[model samples]
Target: MIKILAVGDVIGRPGRQALQVGLAKVRESMTPDFIIVNGENSAGGFGITRKIFDDFINSCGVDCVTMGNHWMDKRDIYEFRDHPQIVLPANMSNVDDPAKGLRILESKSGVRVAVMNLLGKVFMKGENSCPFAMVDKMLDLTPSYVKVRLLDVHAEATSEKQGLGQYLAGRLSAVYGTHSHVPTADERILKNHTGFVTDLGMTGPYDSVIGIDPDSAVRRLRTGEKRNFEPAKNDLWFYGMLFEINEDSGACTGVHRLRFPAKDS
Candidate 1:
């Protein structure tokens, strides 16, 4: 079986620290064959920087980093967009990267895996392509040798995320949600083949409003201020999902949700 861990969006510096601590604890209990994290908000809760990306790969030993609507918020991303560990939203309307939403990677145990990301149109601001159509094309183009396939649906609506999970139930090994910053309770196997989750939740300061400072988030929300937001500094948390897949059949055998407070990590 291939063990894969998918972490929720990393909010900011606190989230980064939570990640390192959480990884330390997970290593003490169980080691994952592969680990992927959504880091679109790692840089001051807006977008990830190249330096943060490098630390995630080199320091945290992450396998892949996924992004969402804010993928372009950090200009430094363009410098490392081609890096093997970075996975951008495939259906992004203005994106023209080489990965094309699908990346074939090798796990620590030498199992071939593929990571894909898609942007949703429901309640979103981009003129992105149809995620369903784009995913079908991506799967068709993906090499057959890569069996363990995983996708991160960076969406806002729970229904849209769940619908996509069902749409690719038997085709993909796992279909999980991201971008909402609130983790959902649903984590299960679909059609006895695919692992599904509504959302992986936020991996940062839970005390704040979705990782932003309480005062700043409310200041803009209540007063319609245009000032930049800052990340919260306390009450760190970690959120993620773990999936066990049949390496040869590319079927998910087990799916579990994982959450940890700063104290536990």
Candidate 2:
């Protein structure tokens, strides 16, 4: 079985620090064969920067970096959007470039893995295409030799994410949810072939509202106040999923949730 560690969205500076601390602890113990992180909000809680992306791969030992709706918030992403390690949303209606949506990379164990990203349209601002159709097309285009497929469906609705996971149960090795910073309790193996989770959660300040300052979030949510937002500083945590996949058949044999700073650790 090949172990893959999939992390949730990194919020901001606090998240980066948590990543540094949590990753070191997990790497020393769990020692995942491959690692993928959702970093759409790594840059000041909006979008990822080129430096942060490189740091995630070079310093953090992350194999793949997935994106979400806020991916374009940094604006500098175009400088390195074509990088092999980075992936953007495939079905984003506003995106004219379609190159980074899907990528096939060789893991540390020399296994080729297909990684894809898609955006959800429900309650989201953009008018993106149907994720089901787009993913089906993307899967068809992927070379048959490459198994162990993974997807980061950065979406809003739980129903939509679960529906997509159920739809692609036997076809893909794993289907995970992101975008929503809060983690869900529902995580299981779908059809005994795929590892699925509603949301891996955010690797940032858990004491606040979805990684942001609670006061700011309250103002924005309750009063529709417009102001600059700030990332929370306390209670940093890293949330993710670990999957053990049968390399030959591309079936997930076992799955585990990873939360750093365990009591035993």
**TM values, all candidates:** 0.97, 0.96
Q: Which model scores highest in TM-score?
A: 1
**Local accuracy of candidate 2 as per-residue lDDT tens digits, 1-265:** 7899999999898899888788888888877888999999999999998889989999989999999999889978989888998888989986634456889998899998889999988988878989998888889878888879999999999999999999999999999999999999788999999899999999989888999998888899998995768788888888999999988899998889988642113
- lDDT per model vs. reference: 0.91, 0.89
Which portions of model 1 show Cα errors greater than 4 Å?
A: 96-98, 263-265
Q: Tell me the spans in candidate 2 whose CA falls farther than 4 Å from its real position.
A: 96-99, 261-265
TM-score of 1: 0.97
Tens digits of per-residue lDDT, candidate 1, 168-233, equal: 999999999999999999899999999999999988999998899888889999999956688888
What is residue 179's positional error in candidate 2, in angstroms?
0.7
